[model samples]
Target: MNLAARVITELFQPTVTVALLLLFSPAVEPGFPGTAWFGAVAVLFVCVLPLAAVVLLVRLGKVTDHHVSDRRQRAPVLAMAAVSLLAGLCLLLAIDAPRSVIAMMLATVGGVAVLAVISLFWKISGHAGSIAFATAVAVLTLGAPWSPVLLLIPAVCWSRVVLRAHTVAQVVAGAVVGGGVTTLLWWLLLELTVRRA
Candidate 1:
């Protein structure tokens, strides 16, 4: 049970989830010029670089674990990730990435910022939040066909709890913040893009 929970947590960690989402963006909006490059840039800054920071910090003993389960150690990590995210966003804009990809990145930035702020005093389940955000975005972009992804939210939340990483309230809050904020932001961005087009 413990191993299964850990496996799920690691598999759907934020960096992995974000990487998959970006890599899959091309499929969502086909034929956009430089679509593959957009995903590569996003994965580099938002996923690769941030993940490197965490691994380095863990090696340096600044972070107790790769997951950064210690809330006290999360700020610097989140800050580093935010820098990477902002850099990615800027580069994506400069390169004229597709509107759908840009919208997804923007929503990602917002979600990370919110989670960073919330992690200050509370140990939120980042696992739950990340999976929920990914699921929400999948549903929003892929429509009813992808609605089934919603099941991932509770599954991830349960994994977090089973591992004793977070309380029920913390996981629930993570899901709400992750799903709600990203959903609203992604939806609004897509709507605005449509309106302008």
Candidate 2:
């Protein structure tokens, strides 16, 4: 594939997406919520899950003589994501921690969930859906973290498009999937946790 295609694929890939999300989150939202220990957990969930998926796919491909790209096994991928989200939530709730810590944990869970969904869509559609979903969130959320996240979204989308790993449509679709899901989760958490208190 060309450079653009490689960039696109890298951007859309779960590992890359999660890493970028994690990086951006800390960068935009300063101060380590609580113990800073939770950050390690977040990094593990973001990085390990995708790496595991890639390993599984590679092994399965070799053993079964089938082309097992991340897209082909949506169930496992989503399951991993759900597991990570649950883990993050449990950690946050169990800590008897500060509100900031809890909020940060909730945000991480929401973000990872969004990344998983986007990966699934990228496997199927391409980039267009991702971009559309992201754009909608950017417009609706305005000054929220979701909107700021849009900054990274375009770079990721463009990388995928340039690499030709995904068609413009697929890249957009992935953005939509990522942005919409994350925004919804974040909003729900805010309402349930922050507003209720």
Candidate 3:
């Protein structure tokens, strides 16, 4: 049970979830494969490099674990990832990547910023939050058939609690932050883009 919980926790880490989300962003845009590399660029800066930072911090003993179970250790890491996200956002804009992809990046930056602020005072479940955000985005982008993806939120929350990484309330709050923030931001960005068009 413990091993399985750990696997689930690791599987839905923010880095992985964001990578999957970015990689799927092109699909949300009209011209897919053409803008596919934009997703790759996002994954490189927002996911891969930030992940590398966490790994390096773990090696240096700056972080308690790869997951950064210690809330105190999260701010710096989140800040580093924010920088990467910003850089990705700029590059995506400069390259005029698809509106959906750019909006996704912006939404991601918003989510990260929220999590970073919350983590400063509480040990929120980044794992749960990440999964919830992904689920929300999936449902929003794919509609009714994808609504089932919401199930992953509770599963991730259960895994976090089972792993003793976070309290039930913490996990719930994480879900709220993840799903609520991203859904609002992404939807708003897309809406604004459509209006501008």
The prediction achieving the highest TM-score against the true structure is: 3
lDDT tens per residue, model 1, 1-197: 99888888888888888788877665556575446777878899889998888888889988998889999988888888888889988988898887777877888888888888899999877788778878887886778998988998888898899988899999999999876887688779877864465
Cα lDDT tens digits, model 2, 56-124, are 766776322121334646546556666775776576557654443455456545654555565654553
lDDT preference between candidates 1 and 3, better one:
3
Clashing pairs in 3: none
lDDT of 2: 0.52
Relative to the true structure, candidate 2 has a C-alpha RMSD (angstroms) of: 5.6
* Candidate 1: clashing pairs of residues: none
Instruction: Report, for every candidate in turn, its global Cα lDDT versus the true structure.
Output: 0.83, 0.52, 0.86
* lDDT, residue 183, model 1: 68
Give the candidate order by descending TM-score: 3, 1, 2
User: Which is better, 1 or 2, measured by lDDT?
Assistant: 1
Alpha-carbon error at 39 in model 2, in Å? 2.4
Once fitted onto the true fold, the runs of candidate 2 whose alpha carbons sit more than 4 angstroms away are 4-34, 59-70, 97-151, 195-197
Worst 10 residues of 1 by lDDT: 26-35
